[model samples]
Target: MKQLLVPALLALLAGCATTPPTPLAPTGPKIDTTYTAKGQSSRARFLVLHYTVSDNPSSIKILTEQQVSAHYLVTNGPQPVIYRLVDENRAAYHAGVSSWKNYTQLNSSSIGIEIVNPGWTSTPEGGRLFYPFPQEQMDVLLPLLKDIVQRHGIAPENVLGHSDIAPLRKQDPGPLFPWQRLAQEGLVLWPDANRVANVRPIFEATLPDLFWFQRKLATHGFAIQQTGMLDQQTRTVLSAFQMKYRPSDFAGNPDAETAALLEVLTTPANAPLPVVPTPVTTAPVPPLPPATPPVPVVPETAPAPAAPLPVPTPVPPAPMPAPVAVPTPATPPVPAPAVVPATPAAVNTP
Candidate 1:
């Protein structure tokens, strides 16, 4: 009994030694808390939007079980529901490998919204089809977005799409997503349409080159390398911007119009700010693609260059035989004129 008792006491003491420490319990002045009004603010300062390529059930399974999650998952179906997965206070793994403006690893300082939709379909023919978010889903989204942004005091500039943050790896909430609609709701910033129109003609006349576009894009908070080359990364950044502003066309090709839009967005340059539309009614915007997927198109190929013009064959010049020069008698070499040696002049002794 003595042996057992000693061993137990020794084990207990060792366990206690290895255990982690907890906050000390207050004894005297239980709290030294200050009741001051001034204090720190929330960690979140940005909001990132994304679309799950899978349906609601699949998205939930992937987000939860796959160790990747979002603060909220919005659904569009028989009954639209906004499901809160991770608490807003905690970080979610939704914005992976992302950066926008002054933030990086955005999961640290951003609230991520994942809406359920078939993001994009790549047909066998190598063409991509991006689907638009349903009206029902967006109706639920507006209030939620407004609340999040307002509560965090997030800037309009900080609201970004996942692709806007990770252009090379993501293209979510694709072109069909009505960013302009969000802008009207005061959730995101939009370029003044009138400003774009004013600058477009100027740009077309003396188009700003690649460097100008890159600089403006970087200033607009895109994390792009200023390589001044038409590289893939540059194209991806252009595509992301087009998706946000000019959903009508996002072929990823840089043009005078694109440059003009960037210029307008970055610097209005004496242009008046557009008033936010109170009752958002978009015109000329196509209603989301019909339920039936459009016919798959074969990837575009370069047309064969116009057949080369025929070159006229040149005739070879007639070969001339070496002329046999008649041996002209060698004329006597002309005698060189003799140079007379002049006498050196005597130095004058003054």
Candidate 2:
């Protein structure tokens, strides 16, 4: 009995000495939101572009948090992967106090795309600068933007940067972003130098009323009002405009070139839709007056005025013999004021 007890106790002690296995942590991709239903409007009119200032994990945290989120997040790694953080149908809390053209509160009407980038960094010249986006990153973005634009019937001009919409505070998808390539893809508007130059002569010859320029910018999806003065708001709008159309030289001044470029962009293009004529409800035509009966009536001729009425009442002609000569007055010569040699005020004795 003692031997059996010793063997059982030894077995229990050995089991206790062995360490327990550790459970595996949860693995695989994390999804913050899901699309339960298809979007009501398949046509996405606006594309609000942004740059992810944080790394992947940090970005995920920011987007997953209730306070902020985006529809898609494009990572900047070598392989460049895109994560759909929020369902496209739902409004992502990305755009804030924004306006574009007629669109206000763009969060309700636009798709937010966050591109992973460090944004502005310091250059050797001691100026804040941006890094070039990797080609691989753009490789993923181009197709995605194409898909979204195509599916939603988004206008080329509607695809815009975050700064474009919220210029006063945000500057994302900065100058280094490949907008020219995007324009090449038919995703946005590009100004032609020739067209801009053609209008340059006009702009330079005549000083453009600043208010008119402001109105033009506001008309083109920029958030600005015609204040008749070039204020900070106007500068912000110009800065946003420069970021998109005049990226090479964005000085935020409404110079001749910028004004001319704006005019070109706002001009109407060649597509015209057929106008349907309104259905004419012709009032029943009244029966035409039954062929007018022609009555032949002889006209009564009046007697000619009694031959040559007497040529009486001839008034006598007045005499014009008095020619009075008026005398011309001589002009007085004004004398120059006497030059006064004013004495200097007496100096006070110190």
lDDT of 1: 0.86
Worst window of 10 by summed lDDT in candidate 2: 269-278
Q: For model 1, how does the per-residue alpha-carbon lDDT over 1-350 read when each residue is reduced to its tens digit?
A: 99999999999999999999998887886665678557888799889999999998998898888888999999879668988999999999988888876768989999999999898889899978889777888898999999998899988888989989899999988888878888999889888777777667766767667887888888898899888888999999999999898878887888988987887778745655333235666678767866997789999999989989999999999999999989889899999999999999999999
Best by TM-score: 1
lDDT of 2 by residue, 1-350 (tens): 99999999999999988968678887998877766666665635799899978777788888887688899999888898889988888889899999887778999889999988888878898877777789999999999999999888888888899998889888888887899999999998777666666666777767588888888888777878789888988987787788777778776898887887887787654432223245799999899888988998989899888887688898999987898999999999999999999899998998
Residue 49: error of model 2 in Å? 0.7
Clashes of each: 0, 2
Q: In model 1, what is the error at residue 338, expressed in angstroms?
A: 80
